[model samples]
Target: MPFLLNLLLATAAQAPADYTEPDHWLCYPGREDICTEDLSATVIEADGETSVVDFPTARDPEVDCFYVYPTVSGDPSPMSDLEADETEEGVTRTQFAPFRTVCRTFAPVYRQVSIQGLRQLFAGSNKGINPAMAYGDVAAAFAYYLENENDGRPFVLVGHSQGTNILTSLIAREIDGKPVQERMLSAMLIGFNVAVDESGDRGSFKNLAPCKDERETGCVISYVSFKSDAPPPQDARFGRPAEEGTEVLCTNPGDLGGSGPAALDAILPAAAYGTSGRPPAPWVKGQEIKTPFVKVPGLISGSCMKEDGASFLLISVDADPDDPRTDDIGGEVQVAGTILRSWGLHLHDVGLAQGDLIGLVESQAAAYRAKD
Candidate 1:
């Protein structure tokens, strides 16, 4: 039985060649000239296939942006990569330096609210989140862009789950009080509990109010979703009521609202590799299948995608805590903020829902008209 287990492990070990380079545009810290292969591939043969795909339409040149995505626990490659480069003599060994990872695996979850405890979520080295660590790379990529690219153009910030947790603190630290607020578009924080506390400010839009009018700027467009009307647990402030009169804002760029379920049914291509050697399995009775990238939501009011502009777009993609995906993902809010109460989907695939993801970005981006 031990030998069988070892064999299974061997089969599960992913080949380095099998790992696709993460896309630069999608990377958090900006790699302005960097590019990766098309992530939309459908099949992988043992024999190689090399096909240069078409260039995607360029993203808005006027917009400056930043993003931060945190990786869950037990995954090490996102923080460190061992690579060999050739020099004059032969192969040279090089190691990348460590980046910040907050909230170690054993960190405590709170029963009540406090800012100090929340800030701990962004400190330390081995912030423990297991099964996968995709968000850290996302956050790092965005941080890089904010610091390097973006020549002071207004920007947006979006995150889900751990990504949201990391960015929430980032807003408090980096962009919240700085002069950068003038160029800011909006911050759409999705899954996490983002309250203003008793101390309020003109910039802090955490008071459950919607961005109702077109002229409204610098407000947060945040929400937490639930299947039933019942409020989610204490950790999340998103799923609560929309302060009356305010609509549950949306922007469906895919133009699918009247089209119905068929429009939402694009089949997402399977990612070639996960933390484990095997790619994620097909959507079974209990598994969450990745939705394909077709048309996503555009910037429009009362749609899944929000069209109006703000300085940042913060998102919190909710997941199931009891599920194995949340096991390595340590934080008090990780367990308390799960929106997927009944679905048994992998947390990793939740971020890739095409209609939801693209719609969210495009809708936010579309809101800002170019300043003369």
Candidate 2:
């Protein structure tokens, strides 16, 4: 008994908690930092024509979107600070900004495990402090949001990569099977693995199921995009079922099992560049654009398939061979160069399917409202 007590004390000492509630976040109502208005973008048509697409600047939205960003923190520490940085701002502008058209946006700044810490976790050395701290902050921020701002309205949960990890746990712990589950329109958990049984029962979630169709409410829309020809690594971060005889959930944003090729819509950063800045023609390096966001249509197509014992969204571009804009979009990572093939389009998971996800959310929101 003495030895067990000593061991518990040692473990507790190693796992020190150093997280604080986020005093400032991106999604606070009536805050100057809230980015839900005047989202203008430059649209480049296939015929070399350019136009501006201005989104609806609605403030009193009927629904809400709660977003959690990926692991873009370059902080040398194990956990990131709650304050927003350039990486956070860039991700919000490029990824979450477009969703404002559908619902009011709320993003909490959590002390996520840093990139370095994630690497260490993946290496199987450090066990729990980083993720525990990150999730602690996320939970606190979420509780505060629900109690102070939710007002019993419906909401959509959005997350990517590490953010997905936190939301998956959050749903399992707090939302699934609870009364709040009815209020969940959908969860778009991209760039991460969500497992399910052979019968499609819960793996990571209890009551929530993978979205089988576009208009399915209270379900999950998730996938890791990869080129059709590229197979994921055996050690890929997503798409592997957690237990034997089960399959990872893969819902193709395009054609959600019922139709023709989905018309792809994309919103990219103003500083967007192809792999190593060698993208095909119309997309030139350092090209100036008029808007903070760039919208490209008919540039990509997607499907869901199983490969290398993992499920993934297969992305294919229909760019004309003669068109300079036909360059293949590559995944972005912190590797400082072209992302490795094994990564399998990790970076473009959100960008490539942004349009499909938005459409899904819109449809799901309507379906949820219809239930009332």
Candidate 3:
């Protein structure tokens, strides 16, 4: 381990005990945990019709998904404790739970920067925000998984926002071009920017390339989501190309390699799309959302777009005026009564194309099994 990581781990207070301990894990094999919850969705069509789509029967897969969630910690301290709270549990249901359909889920609770820490960072004072604290926990958890649980099975690494940032470093440090890379089927690094250099879009890592199609293994699938009408502002943090002439990677989940607009099989939460946490707006006129999840067919479409040094997933709501379905989805990050457009749909990076991602993972797992 790096000296700083070692120091952080040695200095941490109750952030982690042992990876073998079940409490440290949100989702593990053969455990009655969050990943094993019911994932039934209420499907709503373009013409205001509704139906229920239940998840397929559980089956053993040849691959696994080792996921690290974004920063959803509600701890008051700079670094969150290991205990999983409501926000963490809720986000896991939305982001990581659905992937259980394709691969076994393994989500580790880490000592991440809390909402308070993020607020401080945004306020120009990273007082207690320790990036090492988060990175150390994630790196340690990954090492434990590879040594204990992986067992030579092909695995997919999934992360978003803070998790993505830490995983980017982890890949470069541990997996890139290493023997472990062979076991890596693909990586879904969402809600963050990944820069690719002029050396054939390989700046982030030497050997790992972006996914061209579902058949490609040992590749990357990454993008930041932005509404088509509201692209990232010039001062936005995400979707901007690297300063040294490298492009920010943007891979459409619906159409990984293919270009034009592709329909997003969005399976978003039925509760609330925004920060207010209110009940979901009416899907049609008076229909109630009884299910925890909602699937809107042809309601959202995404495409890769590049303009003025910004490359991002352009999300377009294809709601027809004549159709009784709702015309929009809420994903913007709000702060102090103002919408943070620069963040752009940061909250829904996985949600926007969650269904498509699961399908892609299934295909990639099949390919990996074939190759093996």
In terms of TM-score, the best-performing candidate is: 3
lDDT of 1: 0.31
TM-score ranking, high to low: 3, 2, 1
Candidate 2 has what TM-score?
Answer: 0.86
Estimate, for each residue in 1-372, the C-alpha lDDT of model 2 and write its tens digit.
011112223442222222233345766556556465456877776665678887664567788888998887767776677667877776776678678778888888777777666667557655443466666667776777788778889899999888887888788889999998888989998887777777755667879988877778889888887776666777665666656887877777766764345556766555543232223233533355767656667877777776668777777777686544535554545356555666677767787778778888888877877878
| Full-model lDDT for every candidate | 0.31, 0.70, 0.82
Error of 3 at 36 (Å): 1.1
lDDT by residue for model 3 (69-101), tens: 987887889778889988888888889898887
Better model by lDDT, 2 or 3?
Answer: 3
TM-scores, all candidates, are 0.43, 0.86, 0.93
RMSD of 3: 3.4
Misplaced by over 4 Å in model 3 are: 1-17, 198-200, 273-280
Best by lDDT: 3
Q: After superposition, how far is residue 286 of candidate 2 from its true place, in Å?
A: 12
Identify the runs in model 1 with alpha carbons over 4 angstroms from their true place: 1-35, 41-60, 76-147, 196-210, 213-217, 228-367
Displacement of the residue 25 alpha carbon in candidate 1, Å: 10
